[model samples]
Target chain A: MKKVEAVLIDLSGTLHIENTATPNAVEALKRLRASRVKIKFVTNTTKESKTVLYQRLKKLGFDISQEEIFTSLSAANDLIKKDQLKPMLIVDDAALEDFSDVSKFDGKPDSVVVGLAPEKFNRPVLNEALRLLLSGGKLVAIHQGRYYKTSSGLSLGPGPFVKLLEYAAGVEAVTVGKPNVEFFKAALEDLGVADPTTAFMIGDDVRDDIDGAQRLGLKGCLVQTGKYRSGDETKISPPPDLVLGDFSNAVDQILSHIGQS
Target chain B: MLVRVLSISIGSTLLRGTCNHISSFTVKRLKSQASNMDGVKGLLIDISGVLKDGDVVIDGSVAAIKKLQSANFPFRLVTNETLKPRKTILSTLSMLGYNIDEKILFSPVPATVEILKRENLRPHLLVHPRMIPEFEGVDFNDPNCVVMADAYEHFTFENMNACFRKLMAMENPVFISLGIGKYYMDDDGMALDVGGFAKCLEYATGVSPRVVGKPSRDYFLAAVNDMNLKCDQVVMIGDDVLHDVGGAQAAGLKGALVRTGKFTKRDENHPTVKPDLIVNNLAHAVELLFGTSPS
Candidate 1:
């Protein structure tokens, strides 16, 4: 009953760490895309916009269009639509501006959608949002992912700041990014697939991507090329379904798993 | 009587009769209310930092549970209280002055037992020997499930070795224990939880035992099911992030972290677990749940 519809490749650690592909990242995507497998590059990292991320991935040797990339930004936009509420506050940021096509909130958002926005996380902004939230505004966080690796070193992701905002606001959020069912649902809908098992999530991190896929009953392939290595598999408390060297061999494994079913 | 009539007939008889006879106006109002809650399903709440902090529960936390119950807000205690049996644990919370519905209490003990039965265990228990009085009907030979309750004196190194032996023999043998942490309470100060012991055995075995208590996803799911709430509708109440928030997230439940009891910045940022919302304590979490600001 399982048919290959799409292959959702994780951005950081899965495909490329920063400017370099993890071994066979480009070739695997090329082979999969060539074989008519729909490709959607999903990333929990929202440090950059779709355009910047696409450019970055291209430099790393993977050919990806903006149409096939589903970032936390994309997920947040979809959440706003699904929730059917607009904000009154003027969101002055490039990430917020991306949803200019959609209707804007009239005055102060009934809910604030949070992703990995770099500039907007501060005590002042958080306090302002806290007031709105205390007055019954819902907060939707993209994911609880905390850290993301960069060319320089490890930096805190949007989740930490979002958590700070949550502390100030004192309101729990509805998350939409990685491991959240909605994120997977959106990707699968884009891929035109029904079940999650038909898809395989290949990532370097055990917790964020691979384990997340296992929760959804999807076959997860943990690649030892990025943040973690082959021996580091012991660290993942709840381990992944399968372990692989890197994405170069991932295509063959994915093809076989999907084919066997 | 209404109750008698409801219980006399077979399933759906009362529902079909009562539901069909409602006035059109009332039906319209109900329909509107239903539509307002179109996508709003039951909340799957993680219990730890959101409700009770160690022994000191958040102010009005119990009252908030009462209010939610009155409003028909389907809530359950998705706790990873693997140390105590479900019935005993809930009753203890009740005796300790927390007004919780036992029907909605889904601890890992019963589910762990069910899993044990499925695995064909010889009733090899790592629980308090005194507590073994509860399992009169439960078999003792070739016990497949090894459960350890840390609160009792059963949490000794010898008991640990016995449990480990059972686990090592069985492939993926079910190991259900209480929260693996330490707590200092009013009466019970300086207590070691089962989590540390589970870690020790797991390190030795390399076979990570399935923790069924708070922070374990299985208990959360069971509690959600018991409350008749959808996974998305319930908000978890807990004070500890490692046992409460982490487990809730793992079980696909939302968490509200209350900075009470053993919650410090260290516990809040404890390595891997992340809580969705943070509050002063259980009382503050309740205020957020009820659309009110903490006083």
Candidate 2:
């Protein structure tokens, strides 16, 4: 095992499950902070704005700062600014506050940016996005997650719709969130870590977080907590470097492994 | 008066360039049938929203059908209604003074039945009671698959959970969704459609359900293939923007959205699912396709 330089942690399944914190997750995070190891929290949540998400995390008692967070929505905002696009936004209404700085929706847009908006996934809206794509508009998908767990149950995410538009428009959307190496690289650069191999990605999702990070030279740690169906580790090839019970266990493994190294 | 554009020959290049101009300019009515010599081979029309809402037919819809018949142009009725059998639907239309042939009426239930039989699947049925007759001979006991449609009262928490487990259990049971609609207009008001529940199950199991209804390329192609015409040679006229017009356009056919049934003012000039033509109603749609309205 190699000594971990900086740790990139997942949010939903790793630190908390839905609105509540995972068992002893807060205390474990405090211990990790005490160890002097750099940490950054990342998420693929498209349901709410970054400010609102930060408020929820604060209420849950996690000692996280605004700069320590790297959300898919934030990454999408960067991409939109880089391209200087006037986009037709197809995202959750609650998440609109996050993009107040860059939104320029005026019927005819240069791009169609999509996220998970349950009500907006209706025929007219989706068709509008599709039509825009066919007529020389770029499609920017924040994250292509197949589905996510909600309070009621598992619900459809933005992945299927992204695929639908791709199929219909004969064009591919530029994915800007998790599993995209650029997104991970951006977080690593922010931490001033040049070598990605020393960073460990701890998450519950096998594909989006663990496998994706491992492919980019980060050590992958799979946590069996939120949305972890049985046999998830087997689903990914060149499996996770470490499999732990939860974030608390993941912290212990990282500490011991670094000490041994 | 309505005017159908010769959309196929114009190509998408001309359509995109002239879209704004066409929208701004009002189409002129043709006084004689000789002026209606467009190369459009067939018509694919929707029934529920364009013609009637429940048992009551919309005004001028009968005249619209009469106009189509008198013009001697070929047309087919395409619908995504999964609540009733085809015979019952045809009978209801006949009783409502609609002269429709059994062969020309296309719905999702029959195609779904064919898919089930071809795959040798025993599915847990989740559709309306009236729709059960369409799958009479198919297996349903101790199901290995889940079949979902607009089954208003049959959708239960336990049933959906059971189906989700079947998909996630590594056996890889198939999930079949007939129509992925959020809601529909029935006799009462807007009612929940099967799409929400189906999307939930899809999200849980991480399996993309096979949509057998409108907006699916297979559904639109099935109608076009039956008519023995190239997709570009046909025009689809319906009320729903996505399911009817968007689906048809995706399948390479010209789509026309009628301002009837569930159509709103916003739909006429929608940025994405823009129809090649926008008509007032079925009467207007018929006049556009042919040269004149019903006498």
Candidate 3:
């Protein structure tokens, strides 16, 4: 019920699903924009770069700028730069543009950064990653989502693969995306918002998005779209502050609470 | 049981009378004898190291079994060896001069088969090829369970990845590992055990496998229950302190660590587990229990 100052939105399954925008989502975002509320698009989508994602959003008729979008790819890039790590990237080719500035190690890498790279999920590549890990390199998982929703059906996420490497090498991976506390804190820091209670995070994932944000004092609004299955709300304790039908419904509730509707 | 208790109290009194000059070693031995003398009606013996190491039987091990048979003591050969089927293991022991009965032998294969049948679970087996016949009647269509053991050279990345995908596809994955041992002594020195590979799938799927071998309390209890004896009335003898002694103790059974096969002096003074008895070999354990020199 508190007045919303900043709102964090999830891109996939909330705003659009594979080049198609959610029903009434564009109009709902426009209404929130008119209220002069600061917004940042926080997504765990690692299959594509920020530019391609931004262009897709623009094409879908949503007025989202590239600067307003925060991705797990960007978080991984920040970590790579901060640590000065020469990593062997196991990510999709489309998502490579984001890590163009990062240097590659000639031999065994100092670290391994993994995402949803279907082509690289084979034995040889996984074995190579295992060798690198056994040789003292660390593993960095962009996100550990168990599964993601696609047009055909649900598909395997990078979580299982990440776990495979961790178990084989007897090492723990450093997760860089939701619902990691540092990922949420990094987005809040970028928005210049000191009070997390004033901001709201809207996403379809009960564990990663809703429970993740709620743990850090941010009010979570779980939308019943995207990767959400029935009874997902019961999976977490002190369930999400708001559970709505879709992203548009969640926005309507937020705007009405702040007297902006 | 009452006679054993009376003997221990009399022994304690005699040791205390001579306590003025008794060494620390004597006191330690006295304490171990006191604890082990109470109601040890049966035993769950390990096969690989205690009875025979590889194809060669340990000295006096066969005679020790004969002595236990003559006394009508109930015991079972409990093993975590998954490389061979239960029949093959029994035959090997038989050739090595130890006459072990097929009914009294317990291994992970038959135990896992019972679980699969009880749960009506179809399994995608990642076990050695030689152990296949043991699971003859179990369904393998549309696998809802993953059963892993020492696959040796078959522990390829492709096989592991295939199993990984199968588990991920299930609504609720059921993973069953034969044992949780880290490593074991083989012909080629020490080799990685099934636990390492099982850990990979467990880490990936976030599902802990049901271990059906040593260190699992259920496995030890199942063996103890077969002897028609309570946990406190049984003792487990093994070479590996952590899995055998520590596991048996955790399951409410007394554990005796024998100084044979894969055992080092370090196991005698293990940091975590204080074994109830530390004997030279299976013969020494039998001598302490039956008060007769089997050798």
TM-score of 2: 0.61
Model 1 Cα lDDT, one tens digit per residue, B1-295: 9987776454334222222233345334333433222333455444554455555454555676777777786666665555456567666577657777666665556555555555565557766554555454567776666666553455443455556567756765766654444332224233334554555455434455566666667667666766567666655657667667776777776766655555665765778877676555444444455554333
Model 1 TM-score (2 dp):
0.45
Predicted model with the maximum lDDT: 3
All candidates: TM-score of chain A: 0.84, 0.96, 0.96
lDDT of 1 at A248: 79
Cα lDDT of candidate 2 equals 0.78
Q: What is the C-alpha lDDT of each candidate?
A: 0.62, 0.78, 0.83
CA displacement after TM-score superposition, residue A34 of candidate 1 (Å)? 3.8
Which ranking of candidates, highest DockQ first? Answer: 3, 2, 1
Q: In candidate 1, what are the lDDT values of residues A1-261, reduced to their tens digit?
A: 377666778888778888887887788787777667777778877666677788888777778787888876777776677768674222326555566655454555676666665455433344456556767988777776655566654444555445544543446777778767667667778878778877877777676687776777677778877666346566665777778888878888877755675
Error of 3 at A159 (Å): 4.0
Highest DockQ: which candidate? 3
> Which portions of model 2 miss their true places by more than 4 Å?
A105-107, B1-108, B111-144, B148-172, B177-295
The two-chain DockQ for each candidate, comma-separated, is: 0.01, 0.06, 0.13
Native A-B contacts reproduced, model 1:
0.00
- Could you give candidate 2's per-residue lDDT for residues A57-163 as a string of tens digits? 89999999987888899999999999989988888889998899888555568888888786676545665666677678999999887666666655556776676
Q: In candidate 2 chain A, what residue range of length 10 has the lowest lDDT sum? A: A121-130
Quality of candidate 3's docking, in CAPRI categories?
incorrect
